[model samples]
Target: MSEDAEKIIERLAQDLRAGQFTPGSWLKQVDLQKRYGVGRAPVRKALEALAGRRLIRHEKNRGYSVHPADTEEADQVLDIRVAIETGFAEAICRNAVEADIVELGGLAAEFEKIAINGPFHLLYDANLAFHGALLGCARNPAMVALVADLRMRTSPAPASQWLDRSRIERSAQEHYDMVEAVRTSDAAGLARLIRDHILQRAD
Candidate 1:
C-alpha cells in the first residue's frame, strides 16, 4: 500500500510475467529485498499482493513461490476469454464510438513500439493497456475485470516465448486490423480476430 510497496509490486509482477523467475520457484523475502533493494515490509506486501492476484502462492512455512504455469488451466482461461471477449467485441461493435477506435489505436501503437525494444515489463504494461482500452468499450466492468484476471493467469511466459520474437511485428499488424474491424462495425470479423488473437501461435 505504501509507495515503496507499490513500486515493488509492479517490479515483481513484471518479472513474474516476463518469466524472469522460473515457475514454482521459491521467493524468499530476503532475496527479493536484495533484488529490489527494498525492505522486508515492502517485499512481504508485494508478495501478498501478487498472491492475491493468483500470480504466486503463499505457504504456511515456505513464504511464496511463482505460480506454476498450468497449461490446461491456461488453455481453459484463454478459452473462456475468447468467448467473453468475442461477445464483448460484438457488443462494442453494436454501439461503438469513433473515440473508442482512437483510444485503442493509440494503445496499439504504444504496445508495438514497446514490444520492439522496451523492457519486457514496459511491453507487458503496454499490452495490458491496449487490452484494457479494448475492454473499456464494453458495457460491464465485471466483464473487463474478468478478462484482465484471466489474462494474468495466462501471464507472459507462455505467450512471451513467441511474443518476444519478430512475431511481435505480426501481432502489431493484428492490432491495426482490430482497429479496422471495429471501425467498420465488422462484428463477425472482430469476433474471429478476437478468437485468433487469443488462440493463435506463432510459427
Candidate 2:
C-alpha cells in the first residue's frame, strides 16, 4: 500500500475504534469524502480494503456498511484460535530458541507499558506483534500465513467500552504469563493461558 493509502486505513481504523461509525450503518462515499477530506479514490480504496477483511460489507448498489459485531461469531473464532494456537505453543516448546524468548520478553514489556498508558492503539499494535512473534516461533510458514490473515480478519472490537486501567492491567498480566510460559517451554501451560485469556470476557 502507498503511504497515503496506509494513512487512510489507519485513520479509518481509528474512527472505527472510536465509535465514529456504527455497525450496519452505510458508509457513503460522498459522506466519507466530506468526513475524511479526501477524494473518491482513497475513500474507495479504504472501503474496499476493509470490505475484503470482512470489516465492512459492500453491496452491488448499496455502497458499504460496517459489519455487525457478532459476539457469537467472535466466540467461535476464539475457539478455533485457541485450538490452533495451543498446538502451536507445543511446537514452539519443542523448537524455540533463546533469541525467541528474549524477543518475546521485550514485546511483553512493551505491552506492560501500554497498559499503564491511556492510548489503546499502541497497545493493540504491541499485542499483535507479541502474538505474531509467537506464531513465528512455531516455524511453520503456512500456519504463520493463516494466523496473520486471521489476525486481520479478527481485529478486536473498539476498546472504548472496555478501556479501563484495571482491564489494561489484567491484560498486561496475561501477556506476562504468556511470555513466561513460552520461555519455560511449557506448551500445555501456554495453551491453557491463551485459551483462558481469550475467553475471559466471554464469561
Candidate 3:
C-alpha cells in the first residue's frame, strides 16, 4: 500500500475495532472519503483491505458493510485458534528458555494491570500483545502467521466480554498457568492451558 492508503486503512480499521460503525451497515465510499478527508483512491484501497480481512463485506452494489456477527462462524474460528495455539504452546514448552517464560510473565502482568484500569482499547491491545508474545516463544513464524489469520475476522472487539473484570482476571490467571507449564517443559499441560485460555469467555 502507498502511505496514503495505509494511513486510511489503519484509521478505518481502528474505527471498526472501536465499534464506531454498526455491524451490517453499508459504508459508502463517498461518505468515507468525506469523513476521512481523503481522495477516492485511498478510500477504495482502504475498503478493499478491510474486505480482505472480512472485517467488512463488499457486495456488488452495496459497496461495503461491517461484517455482521455470526455465532457459527465465530465458533469455527475459535476452534481453529485452539488447534493453532495448542500446538504453539507445545512447541514453546519444548523449546523455551528461562528468559522466554520471564517475558511471558511480564506481558501477562502488563495486560492484567491494564485490565483493572482500562480504556478498553488499551486492555485489548495488551491482550493482543500478551498472546502474540506467547506465540513468539514457539519460534515457528508459520504458526504465528496462521494464528493471526484465524483471529482476523473473529475479533471480540464488538463483544462486551472485556466489560467483565472477572473474566479478565480469569484470562490473566490462565496466562500464568501457561507460563508455569512452559517453565516446567510440560508440553501436554501447556497445550491444555493454551486451548482453555483461548476459549474462555471468548464469544
TM-scores for candidates 1 onward, in order = 0.77, 0.74, 0.85
Best prediction by lDDT: 1
- The digit string of per-residue lDDT tens for model 3 on 23-122 reads 6688999999888988899999999987887767899976898767655777788888888787666678777888888888998888778767765557
Which runs of model 2 end up more than 4 angstroms from their true locations?
1-20, 33-42, 117-121, 140-163, 201-203
lDDT of 1 by residue, 1-203 (tens): 23588989989987776678887789999999889887899999999998988777899887898767766777877888888989888787866698888998998888788667766556556666777777777767898877766676776573564545667777778887888888999989988888898887421
Global lDDT of each model?
A: 0.78, 0.73, 0.77
Candidate 3 lDDT score at position 62: 61
Clashing residue pairs in candidate 3 (N, C-alpha, C atoms within 3 angstroms): none
Worst 10 residues of 1 by lDDT: 155-164
Arranged by TM-score with the best first, the candidates are 3, 1, 2
TM-score, predicted candidate 2 vs. hidden true structure: 0.74
After the best TM-score superposition of candidate 2, give how far the Cα of residue 71 lies from its true spot, in angstroms.
Answer: 3.8
Distance from true location, Cα of 28 in model 2, Å = 1.8
Best prediction by TM-score: 3
How many pairs of residues collide in each model? Answer: 0, 0, 0
Where is the poorest 10-residue window by lDDT in model 2? Answer: 152-161
